[model samples]
Target chain A: MTKTTSDITKRTSIGAQRNPASEEAILTAAGALLSEGGLAAFSIEAVARRAKAGKPTIYRWWPSKAALLLDVYHRQKGETFYADTGNTRVDLIAFLESLLGFWKKNGGEVFRSVIAEAQSDPAALEALRDYAVTRCRASGIILERGVTRGEIRADLDIPLVMELFSSFCWQRLLTGRLDASRAQLAHLVDAVLTGFASKESHAQ
Target chain B: MTKTTSDITKRTSIGAQRNPASEEAILTAAGALLSEGGLAAFSIEAVARRAKAGKPTIYRWWPSKAALLLDVYHRQKGETFYADTGNTRVDLIAFLESLLGFWKKNGGEVFRSVIAEAQSDPAALEALRDYAVTRCRASGIILERGVTRGEIRADLDIPLVMELFSSFCWQRLLTGRLDASRAQLAHLVDAVLTGFASKESHAQ
Candidate 1:
């Protein structure tokens, strides 16, 4: 829920002395390998080889490939914010437009690997889950206001709402069609708000 | 576009006649590898080794790993359908509920790899894009009906809508929180439907 991408490993005990120079080298090497060949070409051995750091040093700091990737993403993640325009509609659309643009510009590849990495490693899965929820939590205020104003049903499941928002944007970014106009985003916001609004509950 | 998973080669003119028996073995082998280790462990060498098929054979059939994964998904894809029942709300909710349960039960791993593979490989990305569009096409009819009946906005961008729907479901499934209660899903569907409903456009 914090404003910035917190270093993923600070939560876990990586068991290595904090050496800024070594850490920088490892991250740089890993990032290069990931960029050049994606996940398949990424390995601790390859990273150690490239970074000229010992395998033990790398292992001392990070537990697995995914953990390393998580740190990379955390360090690299850019700003993701939603301004509190007081109008949920305006806030949601603007947040989504920026969110889509951000992912397309920088976060798509990292996001893809994190999601894929989560598939096999429980730790990675947990880290990715935490990352996603934390990202979603930033936009929580919008939902809170919508609920307060009765624009969104007070009983609305906020987490599910976040899931809907994230998934929608992720889908577009993943598929390379995220260049939706603000007007289009406006339409989507309207539908989602209408779905979450109280007026339609009885109708359903 | 196609009701079933079409072979990648069939579209590309691979020229060599695909032997059904070898094709079945490669798919089975690749599926197992993907399931066991996700994308990291999925490789032509590993698959060829396990299937006892040559590397050339796998390449002759699937131009890339993503394509192969797509074919596996097509072969193993479980039922995803919605009966008209005259209500878009009811039909969409049912479709999503089943979609969630199906992936939890069977499709999660394969789906994960295909998505991950698409991140770096242009061919795989194209395959994934095609697969997503093809999958979305089936659900397009639902939106069409909603438009005709004035339930959904007549000018709704169907492709973007589909991307939103798929991404939401996929993010949940990918994150493994797909066990959302039917009531919860109902809220999401309601929210999404409301977002796309015709009345909102006028309101906005």
Candidate 2:
């Protein structure tokens, strides 16, 4: 009986079972304000008012406006890589497809505002940088696995490959000239794959 | 005598001769402000005060802040290219080297600020988009020439290729993870070239 009581106490203390409702509400209100009025509309007082929560509660979790904005960026623009397609080509295609889908569907406004805020705000800039490095590592893992399987060149730099893929998506996002036609995506996937394969195979 | 008189009239009326001293003063003042204070310091009134010129004089030539900023971006960024180096390998190397150099030396702050401002300001965003598309065309030309010369795949999407190239630089810039290391730049160029080259050639 004593052990059981202590176990329950530890689990609750960890806060894994804490209410997610307030957090969700705050994020939703913040997202609304960001899209409607850019970063200027996102003040601590306003967020608390919108979420029907106390200012102290909001401050208890997030240290600054930039931290809260970073949390929102993570929720909106986060990438989860699934590269177990067995074939490297299939895996790479899947990755690019999911990535492009996110870029097309959900990333427009959030990414735009984040980019804007990151320039003047040092904290936002750090968040953006940390996100990039993490994403690069995710892609690098897949490329490295491909190398082990002899699908990609042994001497290839996985980090750079990841950068090239990221560079394409980010360029379009920032410049507002993204064309997501099937043929274009296909061409990009094929060209990138071709370049990663060995030279002798290229001549054939 | 009539021809000479006509030429003189055309030159004087068009104001074809730029006042070197004024241009120098404006560029110098603009550079200092941009480097020191980011985009907020680049207003017409601010520039006029710094350059000791009237706001009307600044407005007379630049039309708006975007155009003025663009002129500054051009001077600082210098030039980026993906020229045909007779071989795909050399051309790609030169392209990456020049781009990395530009990003590190001149584009770090101004481009970052420009991109962030583009997100919030519609007009600035449009200008950035236009500049990106036009400049990217230079890289496209190199890739297209490679295809024509049987060095690269002919079925490439030029726009996507340009995006891929820019994404790397912009991501690093936004994130402030730009390490201007020779090995890193070289690796990026190599990986991208291979990724975009013909499949048969890559197999070798």
- For every candidate in turn, the CA RMSD to the true structure comes to 6.8, 9.2
Question: What's candidate 1's i-RMS value?
Answer: 5.1
lDDT of 2 by residue, B8-85 (tens): 212122113447798778878887888888777778888889999887777665655765687677677654465656
- Candidate 1 Cα lDDT to native: 0.71
lDDT of each: 0.71, 0.66
lDDT of 1 at B7: 35
The reply for model 1, stretches above 4 Å from the true place, is A1-80, A195-204, B1-62, B195-204
Best by TM-score: 2
Q: Candidate 1: deviation at residue B193, Å?
A: 2.9
- Which residue pairs in candidate 1 have backbone atoms (N, alpha carbon, C) closer than 3 angstroms, thus clashing? A191-B194, A191-B195, A191-B196, A192-B195, A195-B190, A195-B191
Give the Cα error of residue A56 in candidate 2, in Å: 7.9
Q: Summarize candidate 2's per-residue lDDT along A56-109 as a digit string, tens digits.
A: 777766645765676675566554545587667667667767676676776666
Tens digits of per-residue lDDT for model 1 on B127-146?
Answer: 77777766666566666666
Against the true structure, whose lDDT is highest? 1
Q: Candidate 1, residues A1-204: lDDT per residue as tens digits?
A: 223334422433455675999999999998888778877788889999999999888888876677788777666654445577777888889888878776677767677767766776787777676666666664666776666665565555666677777788776666666687888888777656654223443355
